[model samples]
Target chain A: SQTIHQWPATLVQPVGSPLSLECTVEGTSNPNLYWYRQAAGRGLQLLFYSVGIGQISSEVPQNLSASRPQDRQFILSSKKLLLSDSGFYLCAWISGGNTEAFFGQGTRLTVV
Target chain B: AQSVSQHNHHVILSEAASLELGCNYSYGGTVNLFWYVQYPGQHLQLLLKYFSGDPLVKGIKGFEAEFIKSKFSFNLRKPSVQWSDTAEYFCAVELYGGSQGNLIFGKGTKLSVKP
Candidate 1:
């Protein structure tokens, strides 16, 4: 069975502070990873997706960026956070040629 | 660019009430459809999915959705919803054979079933 782990389940940081949210998958290799944000009534929005290491495709332009350092490790980062950057961030992974995606317990970031 | 639209932003229903949540997409070609449920304080769970064949797909917890090609719709339905069914529901779409495999989602519909 595959499992995804997201760190610092909840965080409270002052505005303009640097941010780092990490996600990792176990029991799978070369899996496609994705980052999504869930806001109040806005649903889940795709932020970034990676097919392989060092390959990231951003879905929307925002104050965030993503990186795939390893085959199953994905990190979402922000140099300077904005008030609008506060939301529940989720990490998901799908095996190559697979349709269903598995999600991790999200990180609730509050930019105070 | 592809997108998904869920008709209701919120819905309130009493137990045993028949439930139907409308979902539509803005694409003309082949696509995969999905419905996810997120309970309070929990991660998203796959309620159902539509890949190919059998436009009507059944999912966990007695939930089902019908795919209408002509209308470009995939509406989730339940004969009698339980109070435990209260949760946020999301409709998502992925382009068939899309290289990037980006899954687009709609602004979810929050369902509140009262006992």
Candidate 2:
């Protein structure tokens, strides 16, 4: 069975602070990874998707970026946080060929 | 660009009641449809998906959905629902061979079932 793990289930930061969220998948290699944010009363917004290492696609333009340094590791980061950046962050993985994505627990982030 | 719509925003029902949630997509060509569930503290899980086969697909938790091409709807149904079925459900659509083939989710419908 495959499992996805995300760190710091909850976080709080001030505006202008840097941000980093970690996500790792176990039992799957070279999987397509994605980052999503669910805003209040809105649907999940795709922030980033990576097909392979050193490759990333930005779906929405914001103060955020994504990196896949390793095959099963994906990181979402920002040089500075904005209050609008506060939302529930989700990490997902796909089994390579257009498969349904599996999501992680999610991280609740608050920026003030 | 593609988008999804879930007609039900919130629904409240008692155990043993029938369940139905409406989902529709706006895309003319080929696409993949899906329904996902999110429990109180659990991650989102794939309840079911429809790519290119029979229109009706059964998923986990005794849930099933029918894809209607003419109506552009994929509504989920179950004869009876349990209290544990209380969760937020999402509708998604993936445009075939498009960049957004990943997923474009609907706002979501929150279902509350009482025992």
Clashing pairs in 2: none
State the TM-score of candidate 2 restricted to chain B.
0.96
Q: Per-residue lDDT tens digits of candidate 2, residues A16-61?
A: 9999999999997788889999876787889999988998999999
Query: Per-model C-alpha lDDT, please?
Result: 0.93, 0.90
Give candidate 2's whole-model lDDT: 0.90
lDDT of 1 by residue, A44-94 (tens): 899999999999999889999999999999999999999999999999996
Work out candidate 2's RMSD over C-alphas.
1.4
DockQ of each: 0.79, 0.64
User: What TM-score, to 2 decimals, does candidate 2 have?
Assistant: 0.95
Q: Which ten residues in a row have the lowest lDDT in candidate 1 chain B?
A: B94-103
Docking class of 2: medium
TM-score for every candidate vs. truth? Answer: 0.98, 0.95
* Most lDDT-accurate candidate: 1
